[model samples]
Target: MSVEKPEGPGVIAEKLGAWIADVHASALPDRTVEIARLLLLDVTGLCIAGRGESYVRATLQATDPGGACTALGHAGSFSAFDAALINGTAAHGEDYDDTFEGGPVHSGAVVVPAVLAACEREGLGGEALLRGIAVGAELMCRLSLVAPRAIHSAGFHPTAVIGALAAAGGVAAALRLEARQTTSALGIAGSMAAGIIEYLAEGTSTKRMHAGWAAQSGIRAALMARGGFDGPRTVLEGKHGFFKAFAPSRAPDFSPVLETLGESWIMETIAFKPYACGTMTQPYIDCAIALAERGVQAEQIRDIVCEVGEGTVHRLWEELAVKHRPPTAYAAKFSTPFCMAVGFFDRKAGFGQFTEARIHDPAVLALAGKIRYVIDPDNEYPDNFTGHLRATLNDGTVQEVRQPHMRGGAREPLTGAELAQKFVDNAQHGGWNAALADEARGWCETVFGEPALGTIARFRQ
Candidate 1:
């Protein structure tokens, strides 16, 4: 007979944990494994490149250096957790990390680090890393969908808050916890959950630190649960639960978590970013660039009007109103006008566009001045991160462009080769040696054959 599944926040967490474990133990298809491998390369590259940032530098200076794992651009050693935190933040430092629409957050940076750290500490292999990623991503997406947009509207950075619980759950699943123990871990994570949207008001290093804090906090929660520490079972749906406290507008449906289980994986829907800006602004950037490519010059253009969904405006353009006219690298990265302007003037927006010199470019600023945004009530912002760009050029010529999605998202994913190249490019930024990079890649490629994950751990060390 088919059994009835449990309900409520705590039970949902428990059931989701079991579901993640089951998916990992079963054979994952070749496509999923390959995707995981590509992302591993990409994230590792980012970790290396971002090591010089203030947060990562602080971590390097504060921690006892060990050769556990390679920090992106520097030669240093740190505890596994500290390394993961630094690496995770570094990967996402440029806002070029992967994202998902259903639950608007960067899943890989927060989840991948937790898995990698656990794999190194527990002597696990690639297959185990893949499983941990699956567990963490699945739980994160499911929970993010639970409250839908409520948690975010409440000023919580899902990547850091819900992502923490998911990261912890992924680590716990990798370690093979029972239902009650896993639920206890969720309870533990629930208490640790914290992140805010204050970073947008003034672009600061805290945003980059959120992913690391989440990954580290989750690891701590899992370890505590492993030692039999008990926590609140109804953390998500309790009287003063996460949803109730954080998102009171509309309650999230928990059925999505159990309904699919292993069948409909959220990992498949992940979106890797091409431009290093807010995910909401990507579509707008893409559209703006298209207009510029079609012989549209900034000086010749009369006015550039953009229509975007409310969610996009709220999350990006409106939320960062003061930064619309950016004076710093972080501001430019988060600003709609700045991203759109750079894409139009430069034909492309990448790491280079957000540089100290580019932020003050006269051409970019002039283009940004002509650009104005209006809410597209009909357009899909959060759900459909597509936008409509209308450019009125000299001689009264109007050019319009629209993009439903950018490359690297599940709908338009990057090829394995492209992901590999991106990793190499980012890795080089951190000054990683080619020989070491090749070794790391080779280790990941041959991980499954090894009898124990001990060898893999040595590679990082």
Candidate 2:
């Protein structure tokens, strides 16, 4: 018996593919290019910082060492597939990579590693790299908007699932592939897309590898398409399409993805993280720090109350006791109370703040125990992440603080100086000196004009 196919092309894939094919390095806006450059720098630093992490180390151990692609800060070389996986994993291992404010999918962690690996393997140049990153990020951001929180609601990580398509679209644009092949790549990636939210249950390392898996899945899909593999054209909007499979609850609106593909750049709105924790936790960290500044000692606070978005209650505020005292440092990254306590006492939520040693500090845990949340129906999460903290001091005096928005979000972006320091700090955490970190930054700063990624080798130890 023969099987029936969808009648028309997946207009979603076709439109995305055509838009990607038409993008040129020279035609990109200065702001977009700048954002892409910073994204590259940020992800690169994050990869290096995560290289020594246990999860990343385990992933690196699973692969053999002989290929052209480079995994930042590692001496071993790997095939584009393995390298993209390894690098992508490292970039997101710490949950510190760039996040879209519209939702939580991480673009840089998934797209950069895939695009960079493809560029390096195919001998592509910096201009192609920049274009690829921009295209990939744009797609991921728009895709996140398609179903809003529905993906997470359906028990899947949006970045891990949506990232596969974004990476495919990105690499296709970077290499300037035929529009037909780009469509095939997206179709193929739909099959490769996967990652579960079960990691939230145990604080396992699975979430760290999701980005890597998606990255490698993208490379494989794109390569297969380039080699003449054909996939269903209507892979996105078919009877059993991507959204239907992953986000069954919502009816996806493709306008956010297609109508604004090029005219209004979504990548420009990408938010760089100030705190090395979950995206939702960033604003609350600001509130914690503010409370500390107001001379409200941790011990003096009877209990701290926060007005939070209901959507955040699951991954961030659930299992009340567990959220109060997360099992591991990785779990702590998602716990608003833990993040707030550490941010309050440390005055910052950098790499050092999430350490096992710091998380176990009695005072931090005690303060975290006192933190609780009340759901606010009007909270603007999955859109704007705002923070509200109302503290009842020991003397029964109430001190309240409201952080209108996340510090590193579009409204109040990180200064160049701040981003640079983050880069340097991430590099230092991975054992590179300030000088070496500066050199890598210089390369990211100017590689777009260069003929090829010749200096890329300097990143690996």
Candidate 3:
């Protein structure tokens, strides 16, 4: 007689583990492989750009600094775990990494580092590394959908909360673990998953470290599982499992997590940022730039009103006065009013727009002070990040613009040429000489052909 498949919290994890363990590079579509390479290139560029940030420097100081794996943008070598941690932090330090549009999680920041470090330490090949990244990113996006926006509503950073599992999944795939070991790794990682949304309160650096910590923790979990350590099979859907523990109020559906496991690839839906700020704020900045381009000078504006999603208002539009004059450069990046002001005043918002001097610019601050938002109940958030802007000029004229969708998402994905240019620009901003940046670009182009660890090692210098 045929037996029913085992059911429990572990059901999701078990199936996911089996799929991950069995998936080969040959099974992935060409588009998926191409997207994975693009993501790797984008994240590597972001890590290089973040190496000079104060938080990354601080992380370097705190960790033991000698081992075999290369730390991107730094000259030092470190243990696999430490390398993953540092590289993950550097990738996310500026909030510039690729984001999964649905979870709004920076999966690349967590998964890329963990998989890369594991491959380096294990002497794995390039194809395996790419496959691992694809699996990890897909899991991260899927897990985020399990609870929808519940993770954010419950005051948890989705990237950190879901990243641990994603990292573990990626590392397990890279290490070529069996289904049981991979499931165990996912279970162990669930306990390690953590990240509070409290960082939003102070505009602190704690948020940047979440990705790194998750990456390191995943490495630990996978290694422990490989060592024959056992863990709950029903970690994901069990009592006090990830969603229930983190988002107690929201009833999570496992359908999204388990449905179309190998047939559907969620990584393709990931969005690349054209602006280096909060993902939701990107469209608003576009609106502001449009107004500026139409000759609506800052001096001509009386009040700037934004119709925003209630979800965005809490993290980005609240405390109008404080947001108008953010306490720190990093804080300014998350402040919708500040970003709007920068766009109008400078006609652009990028890494250069978030410097201390720019954050404190008198003209920008004055314009930001007049910015305010009203909640739009009909907004498509935690799904579509649409933005609407209305500027009332002193001359009694009004100019309004509404963004139908986020620009870099699946709906309006960036072109290959655009992505290539972004890589070059980010590398230059990170202080790489032209020759070095070009060399890095070449490495990304031929990554599939070279040894994974050796290709990554070129970034060490």
- Highest TM-score: which candidate? 2
Off by over 4 Å in 2: 1-10
Q: What ordering of candidates by lDDT runs from best to worst? A: 2, 3, 1
C-alpha lDDT of all candidate models, in order: 0.74, 0.90, 0.86
Residue-wise C-alpha lDDT for candidate 2, range 286-362, written one tens digit per residue: 98898999888888999999999998899999987998888988999989999999999989988888878977899
Q: lDDT tens string, model 1, 1-461?
A: 96544465455666655665566545766666665665566677777667666667776665566745444445544566776677777777888888888778788888888777776777766667777777787678777777767767788788888877888888887777777777778888988888887877667767787888788788888889889997667776677767787678887677766786777676667777777788888888888878877877788988888887666555567644454567578867888888898988777777788888887888887777777788767875456567678889888978998887756776677776777677767766666677777776676676654545555443342
- Which segments of model 3 are wrong by more than 4 Å? 1-10
Which pairs of residues have clashing backbones in candidate 2?
A: none
lDDT of 1: 0.74
Residue 402, model 1: Cα distance from true site in angstroms: 0.6
Better of 2 and 3 by lDDT: 2
Instruction: State the TM-score for model 1.
Output: 0.92
Candidate 1 vs 2: which has more lDDT: 2
Minimum summed lDDT over a 10-residue window in model 3 is located at 2-11
- Tell me the TM-score of each prediction against the true structure: 0.92, 0.98, 0.96
